[model samples]
Target chain A: MNILMAVLLLGGLALAAGIVLAVASRVFHVEGDPMMERIDAVLPQTQCGQCGYPGCKPYATAVASGEADVNKCVPGGERAMLAIADLMGVPPKEVEEEAAPPMLAYIREDECIGCTLCIKACPVDAIIGAPKQYHTVVESHCTGCTLCVEPCPVDCIDMLSKPEVLEEWTWSAPGKASLVKLEGDSDARVA
Target chain B: MPGLLERLGGLFGGGVDLRSLISPGGFPGGVHPAQMKITAASPIVQSPLPPQLILPLKQHIGQICIPIVEVGDHVLRGQKVARSQGYVSAPVHAPTSGTVLAIEEHAVPHPSGMGRQCMIIEPDGLDEADQSMPSLCDYLDEDPAIIRERIRLSGIVGLGGAVFPTFIKMLRDQRHPIETVILNGVECEPFLTCDHRVMLEHGDSVVRGLNVIMHAVAAKGGIIAIEDNKPDAVDAMREAIARAGFEANIEVRVLPTRYPQGGEKQLIQAVTGRQVPAGKLPLHIGVICQNVGTAKAIHDAVCMGKPLTERVVTISGDAVPHPANICARIGTPMPFLLAQCGLRDLSGVRLIHGGPMMGERLPRMNVPMVKSTNGILAMRAESLYSENAQEEPCIRCGHCVEVCPVGLVPNELAWHCRNDQFDRGQEYDLFDCIECGCCSYVCPSHIPLVHYFRYAKGQVAHIEKERAFAELSKARSEARDNRLAREQAERAARRSKVRKSGAAEAAADASDDTEAGTSGAESGEKAS
Candidate 1:
């Protein structure tokens, strides 16, 4: 009789917990694409597809589905990787080091290869022109993705580094100026 | 005496800056370093023009100036070389009669290494000035619009290191009416006394300029507040004010001498006994503040129609043989100015523009002086470096918090910034920090708190730019998606319409059976 009573009490508690969880799920249910969207918002949205997926959204969906690695996003760098890791509750993987200066694909307009092949390959369609006309890439819109170059017939496309502008300049990080060198400090992490 | 916790509680205790009790009614946290007015007694002298004047197009804040004259075109003294684009910008002018050598990029006198487009004028030794002058308007009865236009055309900007366009700043905010005009005579920066000298030598211009500024802003009256340390300047300014016949309207208030008493917020507070809330301007508090030099420029601009081509710059420091006040032309190269001042053989001396607290270290001496450059300092190398210096951890001693004029805890803000937690720093009022360097100067741990704050500000600005870029990219991508969807929908509709017509023609052919199937085939295809 004592064994039966213990089993029945434990079973009852388990049944109650299940019912409450079901009700909570029903009442506080989130709609579609939330996890994907959360991941996508953290992405740099270069849409360069260096992450094997067609675009940032597909990559985000793959990430949400636990299929793609967050570290595959080369353009997003370490910040995006860390953000994705935090969202996935997984350890952040090391991001591949990019060249110091970012490169953008430039088309040599003088070379008479107006084959519209690159236009089809560009994920964002940053290049603009008719079939036989000279095409030019909008530098601002170009995600510096190299996908379009693989389809160019004349091989006129060359990847060139982005130029530095005063508007985009950022100050260097502050160097610590104290001599005391206290082992323990502010920001609340253990020494 | 209140304990540290109690003082902190008072500071963080709601929005009231209780540190206002520093003086009877003064803002909190000001450090009075040595008053180093080394060149106060030096009389103002006009420096001979250098071989060429390199006038940077971006002398003021806002839109950079567009060059009006071509490279080979000759320009007259005071001739407008570069025209400002918008309301918030000011133009550049030729300092003396010269031929335009070249409008090319050159290093500007700023912390950044970025070059700006400068109009290099090869001075023609004649020193021919712009003899064409506008009739002086009686500013007392002159239309405010005409005066504002004249000030704008004169390319007048705040010369007290904050180079804001004077005309734009003078405009009274609709929410805050102009009640008083405070001519900032409180040259509180250490080692800089150009303002004081101007008040002494050109006292009449200073007072008359104040009257014109007051007229432009439509303020009731004006006040020229000076630090009591310059009794000679105070007396001279008072007599000048009396001579200008604005004795009834403009009063000279000598505030207790303190560092940054000349700061716009502090000066306004010193004169009016009111604290301008964080992120708010003096205009928000129904007061318009103008630098003393700016008022004098306004006087020159409106009365003489002469552009702001020259200014009285204090060339003082231990490295200079003669630390005299020289009336230097705008865009005159720093080397020429130094040569005129008899500069010492500089091996490791650091060239600092403006005051030590807020001034920028000159990257190269070729960087020409703009309107905002008030002082040219050459700190001896011995004083700048300390061997075996290393960064130490913050002790949370709260000395920085105690001295913060903006009532922000610099140590915590620095910590947040260092840890890459900018949002937390913003929560603690990071943007309100005036970057006065008081906290860094007063830090017991010797932490470069101001550097950290500046880094954080730059990081915040970069993040804001990223956010804006993301917003633009998002909008563009969404627009592209919409365009693709609309095109796809239109193509589908056309296909469906063609398919429906083909089906109708086939049915008609079937109804007609074998009568003219072959002949109708081509016609049916064409119709579809």
Candidate 2:
């Protein structure tokens, strides 16, 4: 009789807790892709589509659902991958490729065939051209995605490394990398 | 060198710690490195023009000037070759009569060692002057706007190593009233005595320029602040102030010797006892500071009808045989000046443009000196501190925090910067750092703290620029998509309207034919 009373009391308490949880979930039901939005915010927003998805948003959605790895953005490189890894609380995978220098798309105006195909391929709308007219790339806005380079029939587009201006120059990190050293062969690490 | 008591006597010839009487609540944190002023007593010598002068258009920190004179055009001495593009920029002038050789990319005196577009000129050696703007000897009665315009046209910049355009600082504004104009004669950088020599030699010109500057800004009081290390300069400047007959409004005050005491903010705090708020200019705190060299340049511009084509440069270092203060023309090559100072070997010598503390280490000797080049240090590799030791990890010793003049936590900022955690760095007021290298000088671990801070600042700026471009690209792509969608919708609407009208016409035709057929059938039946 005592065991029966204890079972009944425990069952009633469990039922009350379950009911509160159900009601709280119903009241605080959230819609839409909050996780996807957060992942997208961490992206570089180059929209190069190198990650097998359509754009940064679609790639972010796939990552949010665990369908895609975050290490595929070439334009964003390791910086974006590490940012996503930190946000998602996952162990970061080592980036296989070396980090490339920043680049900008340049157009050879003389070689351009006035096809306007490359202009349509640009995701940033950085190219300015009309049909049967010479096209030029707005160097500042071009993300150097190489998308425009592939679509050009005449192959007028070139991805060139951007030069470091005086205003953009920064001092190098300390330690063995510094150029102002005496012995010059101090590359041995302590660890 | 003078004894302690003699130096302590200062401008009064008999006083102790006079700085307290002048400034109350002096600045908080500072470091005292050795003052290696070996060439302070050397007289100024005028240097001849080099064979060629490479004039970079953007010497000051603003928009690069646009070439007003074409290539191969002969320009007179002190004539404008490049015009100022914006209000914050200063123009480039011909240091001597010369013909433009080429406007092409060449290495400049910058830390990056990158090439910039510089106008090369082959001097004719005639040194003919361009007497276009007449001298305003009686500048006190002249309109302030005219004086300000003359300063702008003369291509004057801050000679205190900042190289900011001077005309912009003299703009009269009523909102932030400038009460005191301080002529900064504090040559506190180690091994740099260009300002010291200028104060001792051209005190009258400095005072006269101060009077003109005060008149332009409408400031009531003018104070020329000097360090106690240079007692002779103090006496010279004081004598000049009395001779000018403006002793009531203008005075000379001596300060204690300390590293970075000549910084624009530090000098203001030492003279006015008011801290310039973080991220604000000295002008915001009702004070305007000008370098002594800049004051003399202003005097030459207004009273003598001259443009800033030359300045005194101190050539001193261990590698140099004769260290002297030479008044060199702008655009003179570094090699030429070093040769003038008896420098024979340059295989292992580190050529630094400015003082040892904050100068840029030049990689090559192809670059030419600009308006802001005050000292050319050619030290042996053994003299540099970084050369002798390797940087170790920070032990959290808290020495950097103790010496930071701006009161920033260098160790924490450096840690955040090393990890690329710039958001955390901003939370610690990273932008308020003046980059004075005090913390780096005092760190026991030999950590390059200033270099890390510079890297972090550059990264922050680059990130901001990238974010701006991303925003712009997003906006552009969205607009394009909306435009395409709108055009497609308009075409669909037109096509549907046309189809509906065509269908209605067909139905009307069918009804008319049926009516006609029924009428004919009735007629036929009646006839039968």
Model 2, B1-528: lDDT tens per residue?
235535665755564443332224466577888888999999999998888898988899899999999899999998999999977899998999989999988878887667788999999999999999799999989999999999999999999999999999997888888999999999888999999999989989999999999999999999999989999999999899999998999989999888778888888888888999987887898899999999999999999999999999999999899999999889888878888898855766778889988887776666788898999998887877766867788898777776777778999999998888989999988898888889889888888888888888888888888778777776776676777689667666755654565466557775545544554465445333
The fnat scores of all predictions, in order, read 0.17, 0.33
RMSD of each: 7.7, 9.9
lDDT of 2 by residue, A1-191 (tens): 99999999999999999999999989998786888878887776677787888777789999999888878777777788898888778988866665467788888999998999898888878999998899998988887677788988988888899877877776666553655332112321110
Kindly list the per-residue Cα lDDT of model 1 for residues A12-109, writing each as its tens digit.
99999999999999999998789898998877666777788877888999999999887988877877898899999899999875623466789999
Worst 10 residues of 2 chain B by lDDT: B15-24
TM-score of 2: 0.87
After superposing candidate 2 on the true structure, give the runs of residues whose Cα lies further than 4 Å from its correct spot: A1-34, A96-99, A176-191, B1-24, B491-528
Instruction: For candidate 1, give the lDDT of residue A64.
Output: 94
Docking quality tier of model 2: incorrect
With a 3 Å backbone cut-off (N, CA, C), the pairs that clash in candidate 2 are none
TM-score of each: 0.87, 0.87
Error of model 2, residue B80, in angstroms? 0.9
State residue B53's C-alpha deviation in candidate 2, in Å.
0.5
